[model samples]
Target: MKRGGAQHEESIIGASLVAATLGLSVPAMALEVTPYGAIRVATWWTSSTYYNPAGDPLHDADFTLDLQGDSYVGMRVKEGDFSALAELGAYNPKNRSAGVELRMLFGEWNFGNGKLRVGYAPSPYVYRSEMIYDADGGFNGYASLFDGRYAQIKLSMNNGFYLALMRQENVGLAGIGATNSPTTNAGNGYINTPFNMTSTTYMAGYTDFDTFMPKTVLGYEGKAGIVTYGGGVAGNYYKIRTVAGNVQTGKDEIYSYLGFAHAKIDLAPFEIKVAGHTAQNLGNLMNNAAAAAGSFYSNNPATGKNAYTYGGWGQLGYTLNNKVKMFTGVAYESNEMRGRTSDDRMAAFANLQYAVTKNFNIVPEFAFLNEMRSAAGTKQERIYATGIKWEMKF
Candidate 1:
């Protein structure tokens, strides 16, 4: 009886060992990681500086080779219903030296019919469009309202509704006609009650303001058959501080808002996209204040009030075959006030993309611009550019 019991115990131990070995061979959940990036090279030429519409004969024929603008890498990780994403790129706007740019770093939680996202990500205000291939796309193209990314917490539903609260930096009231020097432009002054034309103008330290309230955005998207559409509105508040030689003088609260809409239609071989925005005090959001003839905030010196601006863009694309495509688009923007800097701007572009392989492409593009300088007697300036890009993705 003792021998039989010992053999029974050994049999039970063997079965337990086999179960442990099988468990070791399989995992409860496997985390998947995917890496992606693009390598791009381009040779571009500009007839004039887009920033300075006042053409310089010496600098009119500008040409260079660029790689920094379009090179980037990203990764996506997924496990069960949770996922995370991160992307970085090289951006060199000021010089040839590359600067690291953080494009996205976010984690998401998926639930039935809804999602929650946190960390830095794309702004909800931007409209997704095919024209988002170049700098102008976000800066001045179809979805120029507020095209950059920001840190935020967002809640979204699968039925195309979303809400997000985001943080943004203050670029100051410099472009809004606030100055430390006395200016003859009566229509350009700070909004202080009992307006003073020469109230010791302080140049905007773009960093002088602390955001009192985070920016808020609400939007919806929908699709039907061959068409898709989306739109949203955003509001922001800031507390601006005035200083004199390191001494704090006064503080003021400012408010700004924007509204945007976009639509796309698919027609087999042809596609069309359109987007537009109306905004006030959005210089920091779109960088429109610095673009040639691009509209942005400019104060009414007499009343010290900010001006409103409106902009829009449209594009059409045709697929010639599985490997070739053609696209053309136009964009325009204007300030409500006629005689403000960057009060009027317009642009047009056309491009042809030929896929050399499944992972490589070559694109040739041409663009033209008309910029009206308010400070220069509202003179209209013309600029042109042509370029070819080669890109590969993995």
Candidate 2:
């Protein structure tokens, strides 16, 4: 069982540079580059090497972990009907200085008060929720799902339906593993952006391999009876290559997933939501790396591999006399793997964020895999990892 150990760990040497830029607080209402990121020093101790479902090991070293989290600084400038901006990351080494990892350039100026955003970034169809059952695919991997690192565009309308288009990393999008959506349509288009901006969106104009691919999604959320629901159908084509750049041959694959999920919680103490989805192979458009070659896989249909997922999440948060607020949250996920051998896994995520002070905070989380049980012979096992993460605005 090969394991992952922070190979893609982001750097955090420019905490000051990012902070200084945000402190500037420009007066432009058009758009502003906000400095954001988290510097986390953490350590974990896991007994099993092949335990973590997300590929990254839980922590075996006793050293303080230096992590430069999603911290980025960029500005959104506008020029009349057109808009654009420059972006960069605090980490430069072991990275691409060309807006790759750092979204160093982006802009938007549509016809509406909210025009379409276009720039170097990932497109839609790369939709990914917080957790894929309990894996890093949800953690930091979602950003990589659609390779939101290149030319992309988005259009926001008045009805809450948004259209997005994106060009992927490495220049094309075919035979790649595109992410799914959390909402059924409108409500869960991409992240929580009012404009439906998120890493999971894929509104590219094409869907071929080689240079680029077209990723598309339609999302919406509306009140249904007493419950609110949302989700979308997203698809993409990607090219598959090996460490040596060998492109996938034979029956290539194009994948797409559509889900409808909803949740309503106006009450306190405990709120709940449930959603389900239906995914389609959509036949072989370009390439399908998910399947080995001649293999096809599907869930039970109603709520298994083939479909089912929800958004918003379930919560049980309690404020302990204002001093401490303890909370437990859970989310549901579905898998669309192409084989029974590769268990279509669903995961549950639960965590607690503690406010120690106004400027500082601590968070501890536990992630579990519903079907990622241990293997035989080897020491495969169900593992648990907990760590203390601190956050500061300045």
Best by lDDT: 1
- Model 1 scores a TM of 0.77
Off by over 4 Å in 1: 1-29, 49-59, 93-98, 128-143, 175-208, 245-250, 284-300, 338-342, 375-381
lDDT of the candidates, in the order given: 0.65, 0.40
**Residue 48 accuracy (lDDT) in model 1:** 65
Error of 2 at 156 (Å): 1.4
- Give candidates' CA RMSD values in order: 14.3, 11.3
lDDT of 1 by residue, 1-394 (tens): 3567557645644553454445444566465667688877777787864343455433367787767464777778677889888776656444333245667889999997999999998788666433323443433432255455778999999999999987653444533323332212332243362334233445433124444566788999899899999888888766655555566655556566888889889996999988888877665444433443333333335424455668888889999999999988888876654444446677788888899999998888887766645534445556677887888889
Worst 10 residues of 1 by lDDT: 179-188
